[model samples]
Target: MPVPAPPAALDDSPSARRREQRGWYFYDWANSAFYTTIISVFLGPYLIPVAKTASCAQDFPGMASDRCVADFDKLVAANPGLGYVDVLGADIRPVAYFGLITTVAVLLQIVFLPIVGALADHTGRKKELLGGFAYVGALAAMALFFVEGDRYLLGGVLFIVANLAYGSSVVVYDSFLPQISSPQERDDVSSRGWAIGYLGGGLLLALNLVLYLQHESLGLTESMAVRICMMSAGLWWATFTIIPLLRLRNRPVPAHETTALRSVGGSFRQLGRTLADLRRFPLTLLFLVAYLVYNDGVQTVIGNSAAFASEALKLEQEVQIIAILMVQFVAFFGALALGRLARNFGTKRTVLASLVVWTAIVVAALFVAEGQALQFFLMAFVIAIVLGGTQALSRSLFSQVIPKGREAEYFSLLQISDKGSAFIGSLTVTIALQLTNSYRIAIVSMVIFFVIGFVLLALTNLPKAIRAAGNEVPDRI
Candidate 1:
């Protein structure tokens, strides 16, 4: 098939712009499968068993009986601290190995994503770049089906690649917001994308959960069922990505582009320039900091909620799964509802309001006692309402403050905050848990993030920030 010609400029006609926006939404629907099924649901648990197999073979050759391989969990419980594998002469727990791999991926994105953003801006090939990264990530996700037995190393490598690609693609994907939608339209457009993504991811996760729960009846091993779910997520991602690649057209390259921006070295230099240039946009920088801090809290809450429920509240696994599914489906409506709220109240104000709610949620979490599943469910519902809204509105609001021609570069910096700041919140939780021996204290510690983020964002001048970036201040904001 012939490649589509890049459009000389964004087609601003309502119909044409709407068509592109619709196509853009599908990319969210596409990539969200990887987030939901692979990252959130299966990979870590699956890899633990694989890593245990290696540990059993190497660390306990005498104990490498059938039961050792089949009942690694029981073996670990019995042995306590002996459940570890030697990797590069270091003893690494299976769970620690997974965390290390994830950290490595985030670090790689920190280094490479800015360069990718610079390249996208220079070449005006974001559509191609987005598709390329998405497909590579999808292929890596698909390869997870082949990881079994003692193949944890292979799984780790594939996960790192897929995660890096996923993060890079998102930077390019977010850069499209300014080009495709007018300032007044960004909140609704971004919210719709997020909402559709939640629906798609939830649908796939629900199906996978059913398949996993029934694997024995279907004559499938649990491992095989998980592997199939991972591959299905990859297939879903790659298949739906075709829509945006086909429908979204690249804007014309800037007419005054310097020759230096045409090569890899140029991209690196441009990234450096972009980093230094950030000082020129104080409100943008402030917003970025606010986003990083609060988003870290949001990520921490979402990431550790299951652990808190399991350990602190003593909720059963089935109840936890039901709550997760509820969050997924409820968040779909939440994004839309909050988008409407932003339309009426302004994006910045709505996001600030969400931050207040986030603060209240963490504080409220401190009081939920063991076996209070109903209270836990109510908390999850409130989290679902704010989770998608905070993130989607923040994305749109940030788009308003970035310089016109440097959208990709600015969004890449935002992407760093999005992907990199989770560690800070997680570390705080770890420290809180260690100091207090209480999961409730650890979870509620996230309230600091929301409080700090709210203070910083509340002080930013949204209309002035928009005007400083050479963009129109939207009527509402």
Candidate 2:
């Protein structure tokens, strides 16, 4: 099969652009419910705690037996080498203890996403792969409604499974950028998608919150609220995703005659091929490493920030939930505004500026120990401002630079760099919390990722790769 040129003026009509843009943004909205309502706000903090009921008074903070505290004392005393911080804290939940699991999943993502991305490129199955994951994941997330009591195992299982789908679906969706966007318009489209996504995600999250609050009022256990939130996220994802699944059409590529299984096999091969071809695209590969590291940090914060605060800061669940809700709406316009800022200042500068804000946020958080609700709320707002913009610009910027004739394949690698490394971030924070008993240290740790990523991104030579990747630069990737 011959390599094809980038897509040319394909679906460039204003009406067509409007449809695609909305379709892309809607996916964000659909997925946002899970991230916002479940991961960020409710599940990790509220659900995890609710899920950690003890059989005896020995479990909860104050009631832990004198013996248990003595045991902790003896363990530390015996191993004078063992620091107080190293001892498993009273506040951290035991059931949610397998913090390492998320890291394992992330590592798996790094290994597989690019291969699938390459396969999507060769087989033109981006839409199928993405939709397949979305529906399957939606179902898995919906099943979480049944999770109750010590069903932490069930919840963890479903999170890993559904998150796998979420991770893969994003690769397919993001790969479409180089197909539908002109270089000039990619930032706008990415930003608009992100902004609308926040709105979409926020709307669903708000609705789900209402359902969750009323779960008991409607005669259900508090745990059932989790079930309702989970189901709504899935249902929201499934319904909203149909727009893109129906409207998105892949760019032309060589006709690869192969069965779906065979195509998957070919996907693995293409991954190797992309890596072997890496010598020809230095800037892209360099940028990938930077993104992989920093994005790992970003993903970690998004996934576990609330959990860390709730556990370490001893924050109220209601306060955490409200803060999360605030970020969703703030992110909506922040994405839009940041994209425009990028247009004026360039993607690199805008991204760098965002990193600076993230760094300061870490510093601020480190100083805020008690009665810092306003400070914490402000931090959440800052996250809203930078989160969407950073991700949106990063995607579109990379779209502007990837090699030609392998958009899906290259973009898949990009996804690995972004979402695949999320586990690394989560684990880092969790482990830091485990080590230092300080959410501040964990928050401070993330700054290094952003700083290093910014430095490397500054050093990346994008325009040259834009040329090396060739005439297709303005067309499809």
Candidate 3:
């Protein structure tokens, strides 16, 4: 595929670039509701109870026989707290299922996102592609409203589809960063977009949490309230997406044939070449390695926090929801604060500092015994401080070193590395939970990834990588 010409308006003026940037930021706002409410806070906990019901119904067919509905209700009433499900005579925990589902999704994205990224690089209708994928995911998320009472299969399938769409759309969305911002401007621009995403996600989570807290007053059952809260994330994602869909424009590209099969082949070839070319830039590859390892820990921590709170800490669902909301809102400021930290101390140092904090958080988490909601909240607050900073700076810093005219392709690798790491992280947590039957031990296992990433990051030569990519290194680094 031929590299597209940069738009004169976007390339020439700061004001025009800034205007385009605002539009770009909205895409983060558009998708984060799904991440915040559906994935991070509600779905894991919700699915556990639902799946438990299903598993119990299967085991005790007597309960689900003639009076199926009533029996199931009776069972739930009898055993209010269902811990593990017996599947084929083996015990399966909810956290294990959650980890398995997410790992599968990440694996799927490993194959799927590169194709989307290549298409973004080759095609001109990026706006259409972004909106199309976003809505597909949103629709799947909306379907979660119906996943009640042992519909674990439905929940799993919908999450895989939604997460695939979410990750694919992100590839296209991230491809726009290099197009919208110059090298020097990328750190702040990326940080601002991340900040906006946290704010949008937090706003929706807060409202949903309120609805959940007041469900009885609103004449709704707790189950119905949870369903509505999950559904609203989809609505929020779909509704907020209109701004970016309308406002962001695709740049002119030299058109190329992108038939289904042709695009597939092209993506594989692009991926192979990119992989081979990495040998020429060792620092960039090292960074990818570092990111893959540490980010696995990050993704695992975020994805499983609610489950950990419920299963390990024995915290109420309300407390978990409120804690996640706190993370989202606080992360909004954390992104900006980290950006300034990067300015003062360099991006690499700021990120390193955040990693150190992550290590501390994990260590502290191991000591947070069951029912210690206050300890969990305090630990969550510290995590919020570093979450946005680590991610935003990582994106901006990586953007600095990728070769020109191949932003989409390289960022696709970053996405793959991210999801790939998640697969490992999720699997590790699941195995730890299964073997040790303790969340604290599972949580502590994540520290190895950070330690490995931190050591590798310390060895990375950012200045050399920047120069090799034919871009000047930011003085701040």
What TM-score would every model get versus the actual structure?
Answer: 0.88, 0.87, 0.91
Tell me, what's the RMSD of every candidate?
Answer: 4.0, 5.1, 4.1
* Per-residue C-alpha lDDT of model 3 across residues 220-250, encoded as one tens digit per residue: 9988998898889999999989988776778
Over 9-61, each residue of candidate 2 has an lDDT whose tens digit, in order, gives 46578788677766767777787676676667666764443334331133334
lDDT of 3 at 131: 92
Off by over 4 Å in 2: 1-14, 54-98, 417-421, 471-477
Ranking according to TM-score, highest score first: 3, 1, 2
Scanning candidate 2 in windows of ten residues, the lowest lDDT window is 82-91
Q: Pick the candidate with the highest TM-score.
A: 3
Instruction: Give the count of colliding residue pairs in each prediction.
Output: 0, 1, 0
Pairwise lDDT winner, candidates 2 and 3: 3
lDDT of 1 at 208: 86
Local accuracy of candidate 1 as per-residue lDDT tens digits, 420-439: 32657766765565445466
For residue 302, what is the lDDT in candidate 3? 87
Worst ten in a row by lDDT for model 3: 64-73
| Candidate 3 error regions (>4 Å) | 1-11, 62-92, 258-260, 417-421
